[model samples]
Target chain A: MSRPLLVILLSIAGAGSIVLALVVGTYPISVLQVIETIVAPAPGVVHDVVWQLRAPRVLAAFACGGLLALAGALLQVLLRNALADPYVLGVSGGAALGALVAMLLGAGDTGVSFLALAGALGSIVVVFGLTFRGGDWNVYRLLLTGVVLSAGLSACVSLILVLAPQAQVKGMLFWLMGDLAYAGSPVYAWLILAVLTALAVAQGIRLDLLAAGELKALSLGVAVTPLKLAVFFGAALATAAAVTLGGAIGFVGLMAAHAVRLLGVSHHRALLPLAVLLGGSLITLADTAARTAWAPQQLPVGVLIALVGVPAMLWLLGRRN
Target chain B: MPGVLSCRHLRLQVPGRMLCGDVSVTFEPGQMWAILGRNGCGKTTLVHALAGLDRAAGAAVELDGVVLANTPRRRRARDVGVLLQQEETEFWGSVLDYVLLGRFPHADSWTGFSREDETRATQALETVELAPLSARRYVSLSGGERQRARIAQLLAQDPRAFLLDEPLQHLDLQHQARVLARFQQLVRDERRLVAMVLHDALWPGRYCTHALLIYDGGALASGASREVLTRANLERLYAAPLAEVSYDGGSYFVPHV
Candidate 1:
């Protein structure tokens, strides 16, 4: 497919998934009713259900998915490792630990979000400090440090879970599984997603060169250190924002990037945007399935993402092989 | 002052091993220079240091009499292009798209690839004789095809000096001659300096105007090829006895064993 056509198709798919998510909840609102709820506001239960409840949740899912996938793509290029994802560097683990600590302290949603971002930033700094030496960024050291740090953070999370009261443990588990009930407003996440996507697209060509290897990028006159720093921070910020909004969602970050590449979107300019669109659509569809698959008993979107993403990724790899 | 690329008090070392020490060389335009040395004798390391891809603490490389460290990376890239010894096999894209990356230093913006850039890339592919594989995935190409594709990328770069490490690594004899001849032609017609690290002594003797022999723990002998590539120098550089035979008014070194 041509680039523009693929972009248009992805956009349509994204919009269609969002609409389907908004309409396919337990209340079973028609498409006309969904449109009516947005266009003409009525002071009724339908308005309360769609506008007050479902809209923010659906938009949050879309924004979080886009953020995760964009971060995944940037890290994959920065590290030149195909297995890299948003959480590969332990950013999500730090966020989860921070959110859990806040939850244990009886903090509100905003407090938890702020702490999660802080935790994610802290993890980035630690990983960078530990892995960087003598002006060289060793990929193996960085990968190992991040993975070990993530394991340490997971222990902290498990400790928090074991110590928390029984009543709060269920809520904590749901949040860990990426429950979107507490994603109050999608505005902040969408703003972050837009800004980071713009930045990534702006540096897309450099990302391509970096993927070829650091030596190749340097020889080609790319400011390798500065570009790597930008990608590192950009991906960290995006991952933090996504985890804050949607908890520690998995699969979308890792799989969406590979899926777009498998579909023949090679250049980062097209790859980044299409990855975002595909990621957003995947989570929105998964979230819709999570909510309505067993109505009134919502499954975490992370579970559904893994269920869907694993098979899709396996098929992609299988076909490529 | 005599050459476009010159280094002073050059030194390269890794941990306990010294690759090159106190080596100074000047490379002028309109010359094809070859660096010859045995395996692990720092030939690749020396080329990388000259290209500013690796700079030790005291080593200073100057391009056109300006300090290479002071030049911005993008501007330096406009003047010098280095083709690495090993090509990364993990990159995913069309061969043309990969070559178009050479236009990166000239690109106006991050997201833009101009018409002129595409023309240069296409012309480069044609020059390397891989125009038919322009749309093929880079990872799918054979070793020789990939080497040619990279040569195309360097040609598209069109830098003032080309520093290539093992430019003929994977190519068969025919392609090897073809690529080296292209570099030789570039030096002759365009006055661009082409310096490559070569394992074979025969091709450098045939195609190079100047040669640098690295031997015996950071010792270097450099001058015109006919003066520096003597049979004795070749023996010391490789640590093997060589039989020099003149063929077609040129010398070729063959191991005596």
Candidate 2:
């Protein structure tokens, strides 16, 4: 797709999904009613539902969706594997472990988020330490470390849940479903920082030569050591932010970025930017469907993404093969 | 400083393996030197060590006597260029874009490209006869066209020395000749030197000034290509019948299969 066209489509689609999410609530409102609620003041019931209730929820969905996509895109570039989505291998598990431990220690919701970020970053560092040393880093070792760490975190989350207070434990269950129910615009503000970090990652498309294999990237002056460090940290941090705030949303990164690459866009320079736009738009649409499908009650946006993305991806795959 | 490259006491170790042990060599300004060897005899390893891409425990290599090992990375790139074996054509860039990546070392930190760099890159593409295809996407190119684009990238780097590993692996005979002939001209006109590893001996005799046959473990012979490629050496190197026949002031080796 042309860059301008992709951008235009995303803008139109994203705006449409957000508006649709706001209007199609339990007590459905007409387009004029929704427009008036947004632009002017429709006092009383319509006003409360539009501004206070649905507005925050929709913004949270957008933010979370964007974060998942961004994280996934960064990880795909760093790991050099199409199958490597943000939630795959264990980054989300690592962050969830951090949040779980903090919550167990009586930290507030915000503190759990901070803990989750720390946990994700720490696990990445540990994985690097365990796997990297000699001339070429071992890919299999890195994957093994991720799997082990993920399993360990899952165990810890389970153990803590086994021993926690009933109220706190119940809260953790809802949080783990990857929902955007209690989330709002405040979390969206934090996600802006995540997107900025992704913008920093935009510099890393110079790494395509490195992805061709190490020596080639270096010959092109991509500085292999520095690139590895920057990519690992950049991808991991972006992923952590999403996992902490949104829970582990599966396959957003893996499927979307790979789909972009499968379209014959091999270089990260064009591929990452396109993947970012597509991922953000896809998540926005998915979140809109999740909220409006059941009126007053909301299905978790993460589940909705899986339900929609998988079938769409399979169909795309079928067309390709 | 005027000629191609020089090497002294280079040793390379990999965890438990010693890839190249205590090697010293120097390249004349504008000639091709061929290193002939078997699979594990460390031809590519030696190339990487010399290119300064692989960190080794050996002695230093200097490009134009600048001690490239200690020089800043950006400066090192300005002096040395390498053409590796792998051909990854799906770079998602135009022929111009891929070739221009050779100019990356010269890029200013912020903006990343300069007009001078673009001119050099376009000239390089022209030199490789890829100027007509500059706007074409890299993925759309055939293998031979992609090879020329890669060579064009190295040319744009405009280094004093070229290090290539298996440079003629996949090309047709015509492309192989074009690539080799152009490389030979780099010495005559520009005084740039190239070090290469070839699967055949006749290419070095035809275009290279120096031929160093590495057999068993180390340098077997080093001199002008004609002097170094003897029938006795060919018998030992390939363990087959090789007759050196000469015609029209050129030499070719024919193997009896």
Best by TM-score: 1
> How good is the docking of model 1, by CAPRI class?
medium
Model 1 residue B58 distance off true place after TM-score fit, in angstroms: 6.9
In candidate 1, what are the lDDT values of residues A1-321, reduced to their tens digit?
Answer: 678888999999999999999998778689998899888888888889898889999999999999999999998987778889999899989988998899899999988888887888899899989988887787878888999999999999999999998878887887888877678688988999999999888888888899998888888888888788888888988998899888999988888888888888889989999999999999999988988899788888999999988988888888843
Model 2, span A1-321: residue lDDT tens: 455665466667767777877786777677788888788886788888888887776766666666666667665555666566776557777777887788788887678778877888778778778878874566667677788888888898888889988878866765666765545344544456455544544564466555555667676666677766766666676676666666666767777667765554545655665566566667667767777788667677778888888998887777742
True contacts kept of each: 0.64, 0.34
Worst 10 residues of 2 chain B by lDDT: B85-94
TM-score of each: 0.96, 0.85
Model 2: clashing residue pairs? B9-B59, B10-B59, B11-B58
- What lDDT score belongs to each candidate, Candidate 1 first? 0.88, 0.72
Writing each residue's lDDT as its tens digit, candidate 1 over B124-188 gives 99988899999999988998899999999988988889999999988999989988989999899
